[model samples]
Target: MGFDADTGRLDVTPESPAYGTKLRWSAPKLIEAANTTVRGANMRTLNVLSPAPGKAGPATAAAAPDPRPTMPVGPVHTRAPASDGYHQALAAHQATRPERHVDPTIAQAIEAQTHALRELSRRAFPDPDPDSIENTRAKRRRDAKATHAQALRRARAERAQRGSTAAGVQAPSDRRTA
Candidate 1:
């Protein structure tokens, strides 16, 4: 569309894209017409993937940048590589390799290590015992009984020494009692 001298509005359409896009109408010197076409193409492809919040239409001026990349877009193209037989020759070449040697001692050691690890894993990491506390309590009780018996023997020996000093006396036979 041409300029509206009375309203001062530049009414634009798609065919007149070469004249200038939305950004050029607002800031004429900001970008060129070729740059605007690439940007338009980028927007079209990008919109196919993650779309805008509301892509039903595009705004004349956006507050944020579009999903379109800041780089130039081009058509996909590839050239058939000139073959020099490099890969084919390498594939046909024979490699000089050696056989794997297994030492009997080292093999036995590895086998033993594997078996030990297997046995360790087969057992529970934390063994569950029904009377774990009872075992500890029994050991403590035995220790206490031995200590009490020793104390009693010492006491009887002291008494006998005192009696022998006054008269003739001997300590009683040791008896384990608890």
Candidate 2:
């Protein structure tokens, strides 16, 4: 019959020449015809399952069923039983040791070492010139820039190789066998 483009509803029995043609069709027949027409149109327009345009080839086979197990099929069982003998021995050993203690001689030696460390640190650190620091930073940035450029060139070469392989695969000879 007629269709409302805005709402997508069909006018099954309207007062028109097209409506007269539809009125004679049984409901089931009309539905079947509509489904067939829609499917054919979709086959032409949607390209939903096509391997490629303008390239005829065998329809792809359905994928093989997965051989791997998707889930555990049987009740799981463990051969080795859990044990705590090692943990118990460790706990008993830790409890027997003294966790806190101090020796006066060691404490005095530690104080002397701290004083020596402070003196060493005072003599070891010299103030850096800002100009030298800036120069070093600039040199590092320049080296990084060069490395980045090299990486970009390498990437381009790799991409070119991949493209060449792709082009080779799509050559006419490759299609001739198919």
Candidate 3:
């Protein structure tokens, strides 16, 4: 008598006449039957397949509670803007000053220095040809050593003029000096 009529399922009763009927239906038919608007409409159409003879068949047990799978359902995160108030204030302050592009000659000098450093870093550590390559490498090594020594002196003088400390000293160029 206990039936979830909304889902078209009927509980088996000992006194029910159709206890041993063989049940067979496609998914579409079941869906169609469950979707009916009328209450207890066409109840006889549902087949009950169980309990061999005069015995009443036990009703289908209550469906297992649907354990809905967990889902990633949260607001997406966004990164904060990189520029802070201090940067904005500094930028605003600098904006009042006239724009000064790098001098063409100075820019060219920097580019040349960068190219030289790149070339130095690319040079093979050991001379591939002991005679010709060794001579060229020796000259390059001497030139690089002298250039580094001059840069160090210049940096030391600059730091002295500013009364700055050089506790953690670093080279002007990252490439090997020689």
Candidate 4:
């Protein structure tokens, strides 16, 4: 059944009196109907005969015999084969064509440059192999750890320098007492 354009629903209705009246043909019934129609048409028929037996029965008959007389067979016309001169000319032309060759040094240099570019690209944007949420988290953790470590080292160095400077300076009270 076709769909309704306005309601966007199938044409079938459960409440209709002929809702289930329409019967669908089974596979066997559909096949039988097709065979009957083909037989009625009297077209080509299958011939299951072995030439080795030599005594094979007549071919299957058409549903309707054709009354037209068969046409007489005539000799088939074909062009003569090519002469040897044509093939020789083609070979000579192919032999006269020059072959192109690349210098080995130039080819090697090109290959090396391509490899270098690929290596630089790989280093600039390293492959994120096995990309996953855990990998991303791990990378973030490593970056944070390195940043914290650098900050800690810088703070310690500044603190050590200040401690040394403070130790060199004597209090005014201590000077007076001296």
Candidate 1: which stretches are off by over 4 Å?
1-102, 113-133, 168-178
Q: What TM-score should be assigned to candidate 3?
A: 0.20
Clashing pairs in 3: none
By TM-score, the candidates rank as 1, 4, 2, 3
Give per-model TM-scores. 0.31, 0.26, 0.20, 0.29
lDDT per residue for candidate 2 within 1-178, as digits (tens), equals 3454444345443334454545455545665566587763221111112122243334422433566878878978866554699778888999998877779999999999999998888778643568877888999999999999988887876677669778884423332110
Q: Specify the highest-TM-score model's number.
A: 1
User: Which segments of model 2 are wrong by more than 4 Å?
Assistant: 1-127, 169-178
Query: Could you report the Cα RMSD, in angstroms, for every candidate shown?
Result: 15.4, 34.8, 27.2, 19.6
Model 2 TM-score relative to the real fold = 0.26
Candidate 3 whole-model C-alpha lDDT, 0 to 1 = 0.60
Ten contiguous residues with the weakest lDDT in model 2 = 42-51
Q: Give the alpha carbon lDDT tens digit for every residue of 6-117 in model 3.
A: 6656554333234233124343465466557555454433444444445333542343345698666986669766669879899989989897889999999999999988
Candidate 4 residues 28-143, lDDT tens each?
Answer: 45345545775643222222222232332354234335779877698555876788998999999999989979999999999999999999999987866767567888999999
The clash number for model 1 is 0
Ranking by lDDT: 3, 2, 4, 1
Between candidates 1 and 4, the TM-score winner? 1
